[model samples]
Target chain A: DAGITQSPRHKVTETGTPVTLRCHQTENHRYMYWYRQDPGHGLRLIHYSYGVKDTDKGEVSDGYSVSRSKTEDFLLTLESATSSQTSVYFCAISEKDPQETQYFGPGTRLLVL
Target chain B: SQQGEEDPQALSIQEGENATMNCSYKTSINNLQWYRQNSGRGLVHLILIRSNEREKHSGRLRVTLDTSKKSSSLLITASRAADTASYFCATVVSNFGNEKLTFGTGTRLTIIP
Candidate 1:
């Protein structure tokens, strides 16, 4: 189970609308990440947090933002969803460093039409 | 751009047979990790090999790293239907420190019963 959970397992929304996905972890891991999976592109990192209020952009971070106000919660938001943003979003956490093994949540399937 | 590339985009094998997948990266890395994603689900960490290590094993899975070639291989012995999934190799660039991982395009393995 990875002791991780993501809200709204599946969602369908129209383009230009704002969307937010939540990830909660019980492991108290210091590092959390958000990634999107797409066909032919693999998994691309969107954002990550090394500590509370400490977040950074990842490989494909455009139009996406993340926040970590508490150790157990991380949220990813899209200011204006786009069709290209329709993908399976996954949340992962590592106990120590990013190089360490990461535990992933069940994932959220978002469809932006 | 630091993403790894997995070889044999897809593979089909019968249950009980061994399956092998290879991954090649472009830059030096501190560590290599393998993850598995079943259909409609998030990924699960499988194994990790350090840059200084040549090989590692856990249960029926074996991982090998060749820094000279910037490549790695994952081997699964006595594969079963449950082992059917997409496998990805991720790398943490040596120069980038421990921040985020760059993932490969992945290899889809189908086990025939």
Candidate 2:
């Protein structure tokens, strides 16, 4: 269970609107990641943060942005929602070991109309 | 591009039967991990097999890695209805400080109880 939780388990927004999903963890892991799952394409990385104020782009980071101001919280924002951004977003955390097993949050389902 | 691609997009079997899923990767990896995602739930880490290791076992799950073939397989013995879920294989590609995981589309397993 990893003590990870995602807020707004479901959301519906219109195109061009702003949307932000939150991921909170109690494990205090150093690495947090955002991923989107879609049919046929599987799960694609959106963005990830290694520590406070340190972030990096992932496989599919074009329409998304992320910020990590604290160890327990990571935010993923869609500046302007698009139909293509509709997917189930999952948050995961891992310890300092790069090869360690990752713990995942419940996930947030977002829909863009 | 995805590092791993799972074979058999979908599968079905009796509750007591054994189930097997295979994953193939295009490049070298530090380790390969298997995860299970229940419907509408977060993914749960099942097991991890490092590139140096040929096989590993966790409970009823057996994972085998063949680095030469760039492939891996997960075998679940005596399956149950609770085991019905989408199974994914993720590969950790380590590049110095830049390390990230690439996940496969997954195999949807349906256990007929």
Query: What tens digits encode model 1's per-residue C-alpha lDDT throughout A1-113?
Result: 67999998999999999999999999999999999988888989999999999998888999999999999999999999999999999999999998899999999999999
lDDT of 1 by residue, B13-75 (tens): 999999999999988888999999999888999999999999999999999999999899999
Clashing residue pairs for model 2: none
* TM-score of the second chain for every model: 0.95, 0.98
Model 1 ranges off by over 4 Å? B96-98
DockQ values for all predictions? 0.83, 0.77
- Candidate 1 residue A94 Cα shift, in angstroms, is 0.5
The per-residue C-alpha lDDT of model 1 at residue B94 equals 60
Candidate 2 regions with alpha-carbon error over 4 angstroms? none
Candidate 2: docking tier: medium
After superposition on all C-alphas, the RMSD of every candidate to the true structure, in Å, is 1.1, 0.9
lDDT scores in order: 0.93, 0.94
**Clashing pairs for predicted structure model 1, backbone only:** none
